[model samples]
Target: MRAIGTIWMVARREVKARFLTKANLVSLGLLLLAVVAGVVVMDYFQNRDTDEPTFTIALAEQTAELRPGLEAAAAGQDTTLDISTMGAAEAEEAVTEDLDAYISGDPAQPEVLVADEVDGQLLGLVTGVAQAHAMGSEVAALGGDPGAVSEAVAQAAPDVRSLAEEDPSGGMFGPAYFVAILSTSVLLFALISTGALIAMGVVEEKTSRVVEILLATIRPASLLAGKILGIGIVGLIQVVLLGGAAIGTMAATDLLADFEIDLTTAMLMIVLWFFLGFAIFALLFGGFAALVSRQEDIGSVTTPLTFLLFVPYYVAMFMVPNNPDTTLTAVLSQIPIFSPFMMPMRSAFDAVSTGELVLSVVLALATIPLLVWVASTVYQRGVLHTGGRMKLSEAFARR
Candidate 1:
């Protein structure tokens, strides 16, 4: 109970001290504003465009029979192809004279005009239609069944599903990718930003000689724990704010309506990883900050650790597309050092099994105590050593 009180007091103090500062609030406000603006701009662009493509085609006089097949193909794609029945010479003239104008010209004007370039899928449609028309003409010449040829063509028509699903209102590549990217970006920023904040807080207390006074009243371990708990709450608040903003933006734009996201599961994973990731990085950062006597030395001390954090991020990117199911991913997922980033990503894709997820959580939970012990020991030894930057070897060598 006494230890809990000390931790609570430290946490409250850290939250007030950091948040009440002008610099911190200003930075947070700016970041939020930028995020909101970006969301708005992206939404606007995405919503503004129509899905249909415009195509224009000049059909030869003899190719009048091809019109129905072409129309059927274009209809499937929600596109209109302007068909003009004209002589071969007239069709060639229209295309050669002005390609764009000919294609864009009124469909009723002439059948020999050029058409606009449509989507690649529409190219297949055009080919199917032309083939069907050719088959019909050949059947007519051979005195065969035109109905049979038409039936075969209909059977062979491509089964094209919408890139944008109608019922859920989610796009094939858009919402899922957006969620994955947003989650990754948010988690990366949260871990790095909050970890650095913890470092800065530690450095500030040591530099101000405030920690010495606090240490006299409470155990160093207690102080460290309290500081971390307090700062971690602050980090959680920041994440909630950012995450809420993102979710609200998506909801406002009706982007979430069509997409099926396991929000409950995702939120749970996010909160879990946030704390675990924070605990792992914050303690290390705090210890590193203590080793430096001056602010200038802080950057140098944390640089190597920062690089370590980046390694998992890079690996996550590479692994997201490839072997999301391989041994490497399973190994990385279970490793606490990489779980904060890698596990969340694997969860996003629904690639991890229940056993793997449980094992990952257990491993991460086990690592926390070991990390905290090491960080606290380093902090206790290096905090008072103000002569020069303490070497990691020297800190470990001390009792």
Candidate 2:
């Protein structure tokens, strides 16, 4: 019971230091503002009225036969082009004033005039019009059906079949791939950043010799537990706020109406993963921190753990977003440290099963006890040393 009291005292200090700071509140506000701006931009694009370029172009007599062909090409791209006909003088005036481009002269080599560099969409339209007109002219002269030739060319490739029940083209929202990736990445960043803060705080106390006075009454294991619990709670609070802001923004904007992404399930995963991920690192950081007597030495001792954090993060960012289907993805999502970042992301693509996810959570929970034990041992032996950094081998060799 006294041990618990000592731990709570240390934990209270850490929680107060982290969450009660004015800096944390200001950063939270700024992050929320950024999130709102990002959500607005994403919403605008996602809910845009058309997938096509809003274009106005002038057409001439020579290029009139190519209008249908140009529209056909735009249709294939899932974009529509607005086309209008005009005389040579009017085409030049229209393009110069407000239109996208002006088309005149021969259909075989239509002349296009623009105020600046032609847009890629407009370029595709003009080029398709010219090519189709030229081909049709040739087919007509050769006593063949121009319409049939155009149809055959348009469908040169056949559509393939998929055996999977889920949409290969990623259903309406593709399980909200961008949102899933962004959310998981944010969680990872927050976990690492918060854990780093705890480590730096430990180093600060050790360097100032404040830990010695505290250590006289408290068990090292209790101190380690208290620090981990306190900072983790603060981290969880930030996670809740950040995740709530994002989820709220999406819900308010109705940006996810067409998607199958379950926000409740996702948020739960984020909470669980963030806790597990933070616990292992935060405790490890506390342990490694005792190996150093100075703030500068903090980074060197914790470098390997920092790399460990990145492996899951990079994989989650680069690989998982592309669809978490590879054997590597499958294997990593079930592993302890990597699972925290990997599973939440894999869930976004519907790549992981419930059983697999539960197993991952179990593994992470199971790994925590071993880490706590190791970190406590390191803290017990190395916290009293003040000369310089202690070697890991030496720390282990201690009674």
Candidate 3:
């Protein structure tokens, strides 16, 4: 009870010292604005009218039988066709911007009248449709049903299989991939920034000999816990606000109408991984910072740990999106340290099994206690050592 009370007091002090400051407030506001601006930009690009060519084709009564085939072929090639029924003479007269081409005369050998040079796609569709129409006529003349023969030809397409598996996130260009990229980016930024803050705070306290004063009253482990908790709370607030703003912007704009993504589950996973990842990195930063009394030397001890954080970050960014189901990604995601960065992305793509998720969670949770022991031991031994920088080996060794 006493330790808990002391820790709470320390945490409250940290929150007041850090979160309630004017600088922090202004920075938070700027970050929110940036998120909202980025979302709006993405929405603009995503929902804007496309510049793909649309062919305005007019069909006369004589060539009306080519409508279905022409329309289907145009659609298959991703071309838009504005088809309308009209007389051949009227279509030829109205061939300014309103009409591109008009098909007249016989259905089998259609007279395709164009305003100028013919569009390759438009011409190909017309030629193919006429040929198919002629073939169907031949089939009808041979006492075979034209519709049944067409259906048989359509069903005769051979099945194709690829050796490379299709990407679940739709080839790294989909909305789900964007969400995963954003989530991992947030995780990396939050973890690295918070971890750096924790280290700097520890070094700042040591430089002013404030840790000694705080240590006289509270246990070192409790003090460390409180500081991490306080800074973590501030970080979580930033993440939640930014994430919510982006999500709200996307929803309002209907930017992801074509793709299905569960914002709730994605947000939940980010928070979960962040908490676990923070625990691991925060403890290390706090422990390492204790080894140095001067702020100048703080980076020497924490630099290696920063690199460690980036290893998982780069892997999550480059590898996971491309090959979420690969053996390397699967194995790394299940590991305790890497899970914080890897699992959320894997889960987002619906690539992770329940067993894998359970195992990853268990491993990460199990590792925290071990880290707590190691970090507290290092901090306990190193916090009081002043002047010269203490070696990590000396911190772990009992006096």
Candidate 4:
């Protein structure tokens, strides 16, 4: 009870001191605003090329059969396209009037008439429709079922299926991938920012000898835990706010209408992995920063840990996108350092089994006690012995 109370007391103090400051609150607000701006920017790029579509494509008599193919081609593209079949003269008349283009052919050549030289999307649609019809005709002449071939292609092109062994997030491709990317990015940002706060706070106290006085009243482990706990809570709040703002912006602008992005699932992943990633890096950060009293030396303390962190981070951000089922991903998923970063993505894609998740958490937890012991020892020895940067070997040796 006494130790818990002391830890809570320190945690409460840290939280208040950090967040109650005018500067910190302002900065936090700015970060949330930046998230909104980023979401808006993403939205703009996503829907930019699509204009207010009201297009009429006149089809000559022979080309009338290409309507089904044209409709299929335009299925998921969400365009308002009108296809009207008429005589060649009427089609040409329609083009000179209000129609955007005309697709015509049969014993002549597949052609699209437009005011401009070429419009890629429109031309492609006309070509695809005419080609599909030609293919169907050729198959019929060859005594094959054109209907069967079309039934297969029509079943494919625009729809989705989930035959992959491990599904992430139990959602579709677009949503699952979006959530995975966001989760990795947010988890990385939150852990680094909060861990640095812990490191900087430790250096500040040590430089002023404030820690020396606090040590008489509390154990080093308790103090470190409290600071970590405090700053971690604040960091989590920031993540939630930033995420909520981004989501809100997307919803308001309807930028995500086409995507199935499961924000809820991703947020849950963030909460679960954030603590694990933060703990591993934060303990090491606090322990290492104690070796240097000067604030300028902070970078040296954090750089090594950052490099170690960045390895798994890069894997999650870059490599995972390319191939999640590779042996390397499987191997890294078992490691505690990498699991916190990697497992969430697997879960997001529903590629992870329950057993895998449980095992990864257990492995991550198993390492915590050992690292906590090592980190606390380093903190105890090096916090009081700072002149220049204390070598990590010296800290281990002295401890």
- The TM-score leader among the candidates is 3
| lDDT per residue (tens digit) for residues 82-147 in model 4 | 888767767666777787887777712477887656567777666676767878888999999999
Question: How do the predictions measure up, each by TM-score?
Answer: 0.75, 0.74, 0.76, 0.74
Give model 1 RMSD, 1 decimal.
5.9
Residues 1-399, model 3: lDDT tens digits: 998888788788878887889998999899889988999998887656543569888899878878999888787778889998898557868776578888889999998887788888788889888988999999999998998888888688889999997654455768778888888888888888788888989889989988889898889999999998888887788778877887888888877766668878889888988888998888998888899989899889778988999898888878887898899999999777789889988877888898998888888889999999988898889888899899888987766
Q: How many residue pairs of model 1 clash at the backbone? A: 8
Mark the regions of model 4 whose C-alpha exceeds 4 Å error after superposition.
48-52, 56-173, 248-261
lDDT by residue (tens digit), candidate 2, 109-182: 98888988899877877887688878988999999998899889877998989896865425434545766676
Q: Which stretches of candidate 3 lie over 4 Å from their true place?
A: 36-53, 57-80, 83-120, 130-177, 246-261, 318-331
Regarding lDDT, does 2 or 3 come out ahead? 3
For each candidate in turn, give its C-alpha RMSD to the true structure in angstroms: 5.9, 5.1, 4.5, 6.3
How many clashing residue pairs appear in each of the predictions shown?
Answer: 8, 0, 0, 11
All candidates' lDDT scores? 0.73, 0.81, 0.85, 0.80
Q: Of the candidates shown, which would achieve the greatest lDDT relative to the real structure? A: 3
